[model samples]
Target: MIFAMVNVLAPIFAITLIGFVLGRSKIELHAGTLSTTVLLVATPALIFSSLTSYGVTPTMLLEMAAAAILCLSASAVLSMLTIKMFGLSMRSFLPSLMLPNSGNMGLPLVMLAFGDEGLKLGVSYFFFVALVQHSVGFSIASGSYSMSHLLKQPLIYAVAAVILVSTTGIAVPEVVLTTTEILGGMMVPAMLILLGSSLAGLTISDLRPALVVAVSRLVIGVLSALAVIWVLGLEGRVAGVVFLLSTMPTAIITYVFAQRYRPEPGQIASAVVASTLLTFGCLPFLLWFAVKVLEQS
Candidate 1:
């Protein structure tokens, strides 16, 4: 089990470490451009292709979506309660705990560990996650919701169009399909590199708040996902994906949102880096546990 887990994780970490090394060095990367391309182009393309591909059923998609929504909602509620109980500021902490880096880290790990079926479910879950992030999450961070921006995202349109076509049994053209697959293939590695680079830009100025938030986020988030899985009765690869996503570090986007709205971007940055570093110690056990539970189930 140890050997297999390491083998699966090594490649993923290798790519991320390369990005970290580059980020720490004198290399200059156009982060905004890379981020834009991944979010706007690669991600949507990946979503479309994965949804339209074979072996993805409406039932599976529905279950995955339900699990993701429940998990996210549960996380949000738990975070609110934690903030209230601990006297933490809502503006600074809620956003960090509410969002997970499921796209950049979750997707690639699922694909590597769980294979095509897992990727299919991961993409479905990520689709809803991104939706929640753009809509509800952005609203919370900005204190206002803009319908225009949400409507303007190509991801929404892509998801809608793909689901419509997929359910209707409409066949996409070979040329278009092939192009999407080729482009979508770029999503995972690109995201891994971006994650590493994003981490590179963060620093741990204060350890106390960072540790508290990181530990609480992981604990509450995992507990929420486990509760959702029990309530929803999800199992096998689906259950595994939910558990894995729940364990993801606080998203770097949390720091971006904090920079804009909250006064403590520094603490948020610390939490982001600290939580991500915590993953190295936590992920192996979590991965093993997921596999064992799925097998038993």
Candidate 2:
């Protein structure tokens, strides 16, 4: 288990460390371009490629979506309870708790730990998480519900097209399929580098609140995933994927939102950093458990 954990996590950590070094060094890499490529080009391509190529049933895919929604819903309730219990501000803290870094960190972890099949499942989880983040998360942070924002995401359309083609048995052009597969292949490493880069640039001022949120998010997230799994009767790679993704750290983008809307961006920044740092300790155990679940299945 120890060897497996290290083998799985080492590459992710090394790439992220490279990004971190580049972030703090004199090199002038554009964060915007890298992020844009991951979000717009690589990720969408990956999604289309994975969905089209994956052999999982559509029923399984929908269940993954259902599982993701349940996980986020559980997280939201847990976040609200944590905030009320601690007397924390909602606008700043809630979004942080609710949104996990399922894109940059989650995708790579799934790919490394479980391969492309797991990547397909993780992408479903990510899709719903991003959807909820744009809809519910943005509304909480910005104080307005914007439907247009959700519609504008390219992944939305890509997901729809994939489903249509996949379910209908309509053959996609071989060239288009090959093209997406090639482009999508870049997503995992690029996002891992971006994760490290984001962490390198983060600024944390207070450790107290950050520690509180980080621990709560991790604990509550794990419990919630388990509860949802039991209730949904999920198992196999789907179960492992949900469990592993549930253990993911908070999204760094939460701090970006806090900086825009809230008074204490530093606290949010600290939470992001703390949770991500803590993930190094937590992920090994989570990965081991996920693999065990897969084995049992």
TM-score of each: 0.96, 0.96
Q: Write the per-residue lDDT of candidate 1 for residues 1-297, one digit (tens) a residue.
A: 788898879988998997788788898977779889988999889888888875466787788889888998899999898888878778788878878889888898888888887788889888888888888877787888899868877889878878788678888988888888999999999999988888898899989878877887888778988999899988777888888887788877888888887778899999998888887678898788777776358
Candidate 1 TM-score versus the reference: 0.96
Any idea what lDDT model 1 has? 0.84
Question: How would you encode candidate 2's per-residue C-alpha lDDT over 1-297 as one tens digit per residue?
Answer: 678778889998999999999999999879889888877888889888888888545786689889999999999999999999998888889988878888888888888888888898998888888888778888888888888977887788878888888688888898998999999989888888888888888877888789888898888779888998899988887888898888788887788778887788889989999999888788888888888864367
Q: Least lDDT summed over 10 consecutive residues: which range in candidate 1?
A: 53-62
Q: Which parts of model 1 are misplaced by more than 4 Å?
A: none
| Model 2 quality (TM-score) | 0.96
